[model samples]
Structures are given as structure tokens and as C-alpha cells.
Target chain A: MRHDVILRVIAKLLIPFILLFALYVQFHGDFGPGGGFQAGVILAAAVIFYGLIYGLADARKLVPEAVVESMMAIGVLIYGGVGVAGLLLGGNYLDYFVLDPNPVHGQHRGIFWVEVGVAVTVSGVMLKIFYMFADRGRVDE
Target chain B: MAVTVLVIARSRNLFGVIVLGGLYSFLMATVLVAMDAVDVAMTEASVGAGISTVLLLGALYLCKSEETRPVQAPWLPLVVSLAVGAVLAYGTLGLPEFSDPKAPIHTHVVPRYLTELKQEVDVPNVVTAVLASYRGYDTLGETTVVFTAGAGVIALLRRRRKDRKP
Candidate 1:
């Protein structure tokens, strides 16, 4: 794949747009069809595309195994932390109404953070799975 | 779609089977879009067709590319699958027609979601509002489930340094 000039060139051209689309899906989800899950998968797909064309070692360097592992946990923590924040604000668990003076603004704030958490965890899990499978194949060879 | 499934079932080449499975998922995603579930269609396209195909190919790389013929007729499994399919089809007959306005789903919480989403959540996408705000706990649980699944896979498949033979 590395030696395939056309593939390498096309991949370099496409990867940046794919990454941008993922970000758009993540942040614009509240106004559009996509959300965290779709955004996360799209983001992972971009990296996996890079891995497929540039070699797994290079992809791993771009997003290290340790960083990927922590992403999985950190996302859940962010989500949980938002809920705790809601509780500390004297609201019920997972309540969005009390996050701010304006209830609607609070809802927006809460949803945004929660979606971000979901995107992070989902992408991490996806990359970790990809790396594990690719690594096993390398070990076998 | 049925023809694709039949071909996938009959094909011995695992690579073709994996590709056909992705085709099936793409077709399913199209059907979801027709049903107006764009969000689910996106997920089915990416996760089902895109990621799963790559993962299956990776697994195939580590194993045989061709499936061995069964020693005997697989009659029991065939009958069980047919029975389950029949039962599912029968169950669908009891449900309302597609996009029925008076359907339970449309008449239930959907009305409230549609009417109040703009004022309450202030989000244009009702689905996002419902998923992230109205059903926040469920999403939290789902996130935990994804995390748990990743942990489980890492536990089962990851190799330790000392365990790797030189």
C-alpha cells in the first residue's frame, strides 16, 4: 500500500475531508441527522483508512495505544461528570434543566458535553479494536 | 436483497461473504432512510457496513479463506431459522402499517417531543434532544456498555509482553 503511488496520493487528499466531516457531524448533530455515535464511527473510519493505506505502525504513532485506551475511559468520565455537575447544581441525576439560569441554555450545554463524551469513547473503542486485530495479524506473520 | 443473502450463504469464499454482508448492510441502511431514520441509517452504513467489513477481513486474514463443507445436512439449524423468520414475519402482521400517524409510537411521547423540543431543548433535531436530554440516563448506560465491550475485547484478545514467544 505504501508503494502504491495513486492510493497514497488519494488517501492523503481524502483523509483531511473525512476528519472534517466527522467533526461537523459531532458538533452539528443537534441541528442535523448525525450525532456522537455516527460522528465517532466516521472519525474512526478516517484513521482506519489511514492505517490501511499508510501501515498500522504509522497509524499507531498518530494515535498511540495508550491514548486510545484512556479515551475509552475518559469519555465515560466526562459523561458521568456532567451528571454529577447536574446533581451538585441541586438537580436530579442527569438533569439538564438546572445547569444554567436559562433552562434551554442549560439543556444545550448538557447535551453538548454528553455528545462529546460519547464521540470520544466510541472512537476510542473503535480504534482499539482495529489496532488489536491488525496487531494480531502482524504478530502471526 | 434476498438474492444477496442467498449468494452469501452459498459462497464458500469468506472474502466474498464479507463483502456481500456489507452490501446487505448498505441495503438495510437504504431501507432505514426510506423509513425516515437518517440517524440510524448513518450508523448502519458506517458501523455495520464499513467497520464490520474491515474487522471481518482482518479476522479472515488470520484464518482460512474458505469454509469447509459440512459433514452432514444442516437440517435442524435450517428449520430453526425458517421457524424464527416465520414467527417474526407473523409478528409484523400484528403491527401498524409503516408511517401510520395513529400508531402507538406516533401518538405516545413523540407528540410531546415534537411540540416541546424547540422550547425546552431548543434543538432543531428532535432525535438528538430525545436521546441526549429526555433519555440521558439511557445514553449514559449505552456509553458504559460500549466501554465495557471494549474492555472485554481488550481482556480477551490483547497479548502481554512476557507471553509473546520470541
Candidate 2:
């Protein structure tokens, strides 16, 4: 795959843009059609493209399976934590209005954090699945 | 989409089936966009067309490119599927027309979601406002589902790697 110069070069060129687009989608989700789930998939797709062009071992170096595994848990924790925070703040579970002094800003803050959690969890899930499928039954060279 | 499905049903080549599956996803996205479900369309295009194709290709790498012919025609399963499809079609017959203001869904709290979008959520995108805030729990559940799916894949596949290793 590395010797495939065109693919490697093009992948080198495109991976960054794909990740940047993922970030844009993640943050701009509130204003547009994209969201955490879409952003996460795009991000994983970028990394998977890197794996396809370089190698699974190299891609693992960039995003170790350990980290990917943690991400799967961490994202859920973040979302759940936000809800717990809402409870601590004297609102009902997942009630965003208590997040900030200003009710509207509180809503924004709540949504932002949850969306980030979703993004992280989704990306971790995608990457984990991709790595699992890609790494299986490898015939060592 | 129907035609593509028919072709996919007829094709025994797993590779062609996967390619057509990707095409079907893209077409589904187009149909979603036409129905003004841009968010769903974006999701379908990215996940269905993009990630799913890559996944199927990886699966194909591990399996034969051609599907093995069954020992006998799966008549029982075929009959079950057709029956299920007919029941589903019948279920939809009583549903209200799309985007009809008089529909039960439209008559619900949608008015609040639309009217208070700017003031409540402060986001112009109603879908985002609704999903992230109003319906946050549902999205949380969806993320959990993705997480569980990944965990399941790891559990199933990683065992093979561990067994193979010295």
C-alpha cells in the first residue's frame, strides 16, 4: 500500500481536510445539518483512509486501540455526567436550563457538551469497529 | 431503489451486491433530501454509503467474493419476508400524509419547537435544537447503541486474534 504512490500521496493530501471537515461538522451541528454522529464517522473515515494507504499497524500507532476503547466509555460518561450535573444543579435529569446563570446560555452549554460526548462516543465506536474488522485474520507477511 | 434492490436480489456476486448496496444508500439519501429530511440524508450518505461500503469491502476481503448457492431455495424465509413486507405496507396505509399540518405529529409540540427555536435553544437548526436538547435522551441512547455495537464487534473479533496469537 505504501508503494502505491498515487494513493499514498492523495491520502496524505486528503486526510487532513477530512478531519477538518469532521471538526466543522461537529461544532457547526447546532447551526446546520451535520452533528456529532456524522462528524465522528467522517473522523473515523479519515483515520481508516490513513490505515488503508499506510497500514493498520501505522494507523494503530496514530490512534492506539487502548485509547479507542477508552473513548467508547468516556463519551457515555460525558453525556451521563452532564445529566448528573443537571441534577446537582437542582434541575431534573438532563435539564439544560440549570447549566448556566442565564437560562438560554445554559441550554447552549448543555447541548454543546452532550453533542461533544456523542461525537466522541460515535467516533470511538466507528474506529473500534473498523480496527476490529481490519485486523482480523491477518496472514503475516 | 426498488430496481436496484431487484438487481441486488438477482446478483449472486457478493462484490456487485455490495456496490449496488452503496448505490442504494446514496439513492436513499437523495430521496430523504427530496422529503426535506436533510439531516437524515446527511447521515445516510455518510454512514450508509461511506462507512458501510468500506466495512462490506473489509468483510469481502475475509470471505469469498461470490455467495454460495443455498442447498435449497429459502422458501420459508422468503414467504415470511413477503408477509412482513405486506403487513408493513398495510400499516402505512392508515398513516397521515407527509408534512400535513393536521397530522398527529404536526399537531403536537412541534409548534413550540419551531416557535421557540430561537429563544429556547438559540440554534437556527430546529433538528439540532430538538435532538440535542429537547430529545437529548434519545440521542444519548443512539450513541450508546453505537458504543455497544463497537464493543460487540471487538468482543466477537478480538477473540479470534487472541486465539491465533502465540
Q: Best by lDDT, which number?
A: 1
lDDT (Cα, tens digit) per residue for candidate 1, span A9-100: 99999999999999999999998899999999999999999999999999999999999999999999999999999999999989988999
Misplaced by over 4 Å in model 2 are: A139-141, B73-80
lDDT of 1 by residue, B48-107 (tens): 999999999999999989999989998999999999999999999999997788999888
Backbone clash pairs for candidate 2 read: none
The complex in candidate 2 yields a DockQ of 0.79
lDDT of 2 by residue, A1-141 (tens): 778999988998999999999999989998889888888888888998898899999999999999999999999999999999999999998999999999999999998999889989988998888888888736521
Docking class of 1: high
Worst 10 residues of 1 chain A by lDDT: A132-141
Provide the lowest-lDDT 10-residue window in model 1 chain B: B157-166
lDDT per prediction?
Answer: 0.94, 0.90
Q: Report the C-alpha lDDT of model 2 over B16-132, residue by residue, as the tens digit.
A: 999999999999999999999998998899999989999999888888798778888889999999999999999999999877789999878998888978887798888888888
After aligning candidate 2 to the native by TM-score, how far in Å is the CA of B51 from where it should be? 1.0
What's each prediction's clash count?
0, 0
Best by DockQ: 1
Q: How much is B36 displaced in model 2, in angstroms? A: 1.1
TM-score of 1: 0.96
